[model samples]
Target: MSTTPQRLMLTRTDGSPISALVVDDEAVLAEMVSMALRYEGWTVTTAGDGASAIAAARECRPDIVILDVMLPDLSGLEVLLRLRKLNPALPVLMLTAKDSVEDRIAGLTAGGDDYVTKPFSIEEVVLRLRALLRRAGITTDDGDSQLVVGDLVLDEDSHEVARDGESVTLTSTEFELLRFLMHNPKRVLSKAQILDRVWDYDFGGRSNIVELYISYLRRKIDDGREPMIHTVRGAGYVLKPAR
Candidate 1:
């Protein structure tokens, strides 16, 4: 691979440069993550296979790692095990194409901090990275403030969301959408507003991205509970405390 990793000492909002290692056999996916992290002002390194991933981890000692579960040389789980030996407390986010919960368990059991299935959005990746960094002691002045409506609480500092005292797992995009809705409460945010805010202006510009992710949020955030997210007909969507 002729892809040279770009390392920048760019300052984060907290005034610190974060270093990240991205590992995946798919060159395009790896580059996609690297570029996004760099845009977030993180210094990034990329490796195409498991062996190269291990080598890069040892060399850079990134604060966080985004690793593909499927790699040509060794499985991402194996990479995680080897990485743990070097730094057991490392926060590794596992990326996989598999839809199996067992696969997610294996990655987490092997010391991975979180999981992202393949065909994921870049917005999701960046959010996951930010959450991992925050949990790893990097402070975020942005999401650190909490948003609460009734029983649902989003604690940005801890990267945790709980509704009626139960935890909800959300993709990065889902979290952002929910955050926007929570911040605005009862206001109906139009599709265009959602597209511009939750995603990059060009990031999945189709209104369908908003619809698709709303479905995702519904399943996780509103399922098995009274719905807080409501479709406002031709206007957009709204989130109000279920009363």
Candidate 2:
């Protein structure tokens, strides 16, 4: 008897699986992007024009969208408008060959969450999708790996974090650092400990990079809230859920 292998899937906060729709006119490029995203474990679908892009999104109920700005049927901006109407909070990553500031502004103004100029690396595309998903308050996990301390929730599978149910965005580095701190909640992590675990490098006791990122995380994760990250003066930092 032959057995079938199971493919891993990413899920959102509500325990539903995450899916993505890739809209591009180039067949080769669309397949390549779909494969890359699927490798990350997201359900991936593709469409070559505006009408089909909208149709696919409606049919699939995707969690995010990757849209190419230049489409054979309609402009990317126009497609975004239609998609936004379908799902106001849908995160869209715009792809374009144009590198002008104006072009980027137009996309952003039209509800695109991010943009990548053409000839870009698929690695970067995947990373951007992760960040987009993070901002959208979604992540991948087996439903058991999600970390919750008070109102703060961090899903290891999705690499997503939310404090007090408010979505917080973090850079790639910042996200890693926050994850490290959250994993050891209420544990006084010395700067050395943090540096080792988060950066994997010995800064020879002379680097303030830890301080910088900690401050960055505080602004995003703690500012205007009952401080969760507390400094121990001479000791280190600790993440406490106390409000």
Write the residue-wise lDDT of candidate 1 on 2-34 in tens digits: 111122233444687888899988888888888
Return the clash pairs for model 1, or none: none
List CA RMSD, all candidates.
10.3, 11.0
lDDT of each: 0.80, 0.83
- Give candidate 2's whole-model lDDT: 0.83
Ten residues in sequence with the least summed lDDT for candidate 1: 1-10
The true-versus-predicted C-alpha distance at residue 28 of model 1, in Å, is 1.1
